[model samples]
Target: MRLSRSLAFAALFLLSLTTASVAGPGRITLPAEVTATGQVIRLGDIAVLEGPATAALGDLTLGPAPAAGESRTLEGARVLDALRRAGADLAAITYTIPPVIRVRRASQEVSEAAVRQILEGFLAEALGAGAADAELKSVELPGPIRIPAGPYTARVVPPADRPLLGRVRLGLEFTVEDRPVKSVWVTADIGVYGPVVVATRAVARGDTLAAADLTTERRDLSQTGRSVLTDTVDAAGRIARAPLVPYTPVRRDQLVLPADIHRGDVVLLVAERGRLRITAPGEAREDGTRGQQVHVLNRLSRKDLVGHVVDGSTVAVDF
Candidate 1:
């Protein structure tokens, strides 16, 4: 009877040794709060590795990740219970537990208009003066995109040419309140209108401009330069500096006042003050346009005098 009892006791002791060896002797510390990647809790993810944590976690398992905003707790008793389940020895091991666990979710649902406003502001800044007459026409979206509910910033990557008039494709980027995060490609349409001078017909170089030769056309002036002529009267009676193509926008510098006086032409030079008038016969020394000062040789005195051109054959000098 004594021998049988000794053998049974020895067997029980061996079993306990085996259990302790499987659990090991490392200690684990849990964090107060952590972000959950999915619906399952990972012991390794939250475990604070202060000392021998790796070895103590042998075969330890925490089942099913937490859902978003979910909470859990790990007290001293709970830590011991988990370790015991994993076959870790209680006497040799130590562990720390968090008072409470809180879940942090990364995404939220936001409205479509909020995003649209951000894009609109960004596009306006990108267009500069081009947006003066321009307006946001439409935004082509591919169904609903993934934007969470929160304050975010946006910017645009315009095409090689800016002030994108009409339809254009651009790159848009979004950031979570000062932190850069996401990007998307979208198509947009812009409506733009401004006054511009258009050639009504083909005009040869040096041709004197008439009202019928040009007209004002409302067109997309986002990409147009400010120097483009916008009024027909501003260009009427001016000489074309270059050949103009029909239906093309005319530039302000492309035309000048037509010359009304030619070199060597006979002109009547007159000086008048309060109806006191003096007239002289003069020969034009240079081509002169209306409002231009030109030199002329007085026939009787045979002296050169400067006079303002009044018409094709007349000049006025203030004596």
Candidate 2:
């Protein structure tokens, strides 16, 4: 029975030694070159980890990652020191590391064409309803942008308190994983087109505008003033206040409503006081359209008075 007990104790001791040897000191093997996508480099990112304690040591942060499209070199001695500082058990780890390791941040190039497409989408949303006829004449980017390799989003910011028309600068912001990584400005030329009334033929002053004399055309509204006429019907039958050149946009200030009453014309002057009406002969002293007040010579009273033009031949005067 004593020999049997001794033999059992020896078996237990041998089993324990084998198990300890199998689970001993983790292995850390640094590669010659590594590509990192994250902003910070971790021990597991640049090195191949092995053994039981690797799970605890893999989370140790070494340092910041290289910039996008950039590379950094780290010495093996420095890496070991960093691991030690981060509470990694160096005594319980074995290393198969190179003297120096090259770490590059993986990146992608954003082409100019892609950037323009992004800007176009943003401009369309920014212009709202007016975007239907809006166009991007040209887009000038600073240059190609390099971003970290991952899913990313781009945001375009338009100039504040400024019209979207004409030359303007737009801001571009690039974000990777919800973190802003780069900012840049791009110049753009924008144009908004709309139909406008233009003189098809030269129109002399005081000549009534006809449909044959005017036509509607698509033009860049930004170059034209806001008061430009859009419909030929609005300008037709209206007298030209100034000579209009051919192919020029018709403005509101260039046309006037045809006069209903002209100067030196004989008209009926009417005076009303609470439905007590009186009519007398009068002469218009000036030309006036409907709803316009004009000077009238009252023949019976032999006096000049201001009266509202009611029609071609009738003028209403206050008693």
Candidate 3:
């Protein structure tokens, strides 16, 4: 009698599990659904899509990590449009595959259905409902999932579960390998990027000019000259003190003389064959001999330096 009762209970448990499709720890719904015509795209958390990933994007790149409330996903416009724009050309890509990062929350607090939606939004791998022909294990979740979510990571869950619904923000940073890639989805993002001024010159190897890297049209260098066209990096874009450009890719910064420089005014000077020069403050006697020293200034660098006069303000020093 005990054995027969046990068997009956086992069958009941199995039936219950089948009824509650999205069940247990991660509550993953087996056989993820996909559409017949459309496929899904999963984006990474805050990321920068660059390297050879560019070329086609020109100056445009993705942000640090993919975001949740961003306009690109559900609308299917921003990222999808770019990839669709690329078509089949290997050089052209409109989408980027993100590393699947999973998220989990407390179970009773979240429901089965809610968990599924978050997973769908987070993974976004399956294609549209087909003749239900193809199946791909595109999404990877945290392994050996337990029952009842509690800080679960990289796992999928039911759709209705709310408190248990968490996000695994994916970040799509890729290093391309020289494989014979058939279909490529290059990472592309459409939104605000930089005025993210990066230094194109290094301080070493004779390219230490910060003035050219950062542009500022003070007083009279504007097209209309009404307001100074100050194109300087605001805090975030500015590189602090140290140089950050690699040697092979550096474009040297130039030292241009201000057209309106006045005599007896303190100025910066740079000579092809000598130390940077700066003029001394306060005027000397009308006699050319009175405290006569040639003060050359390096206008590119806003530093004050003095040098011995070769003749008047023309000074010589080795670079």
Best by TM-score: 2
- Residue-pair clashes per prediction, in order, are 6, 0, 60
**Winning model by lDDT:** 2
TM-scores of the candidates are 0.42, 0.64, 0.16
Cα lDDT of model 1 overall?
A: 0.72
Ranking under lDDT, best-scoring first?
2, 1, 3
User: What clash count does candidate 1 reach?
Assistant: 6
What are the per-residue Cα lDDT tens digits for candidate 2 across 1-319?
Answer: 9999999999999999878755777778889899887999888877888897666877777778898899998787888888877777877877777888899998988888888799789878987898899988888888778989888899998888888887889998999999898888999888889999999888899899887888999999878877999999999999999999999999999999999999999999999998699999999999999999999999888999999999999999988
Cα lDDT, model 1, residue 46: 64
The candidate, 1 or 2, that scores higher on TM-score is 2
- Model 1: weakest 10-residue lDDT segment is 65-74
Order of the predicted models by TM-score, top scorer first: 2, 1, 3
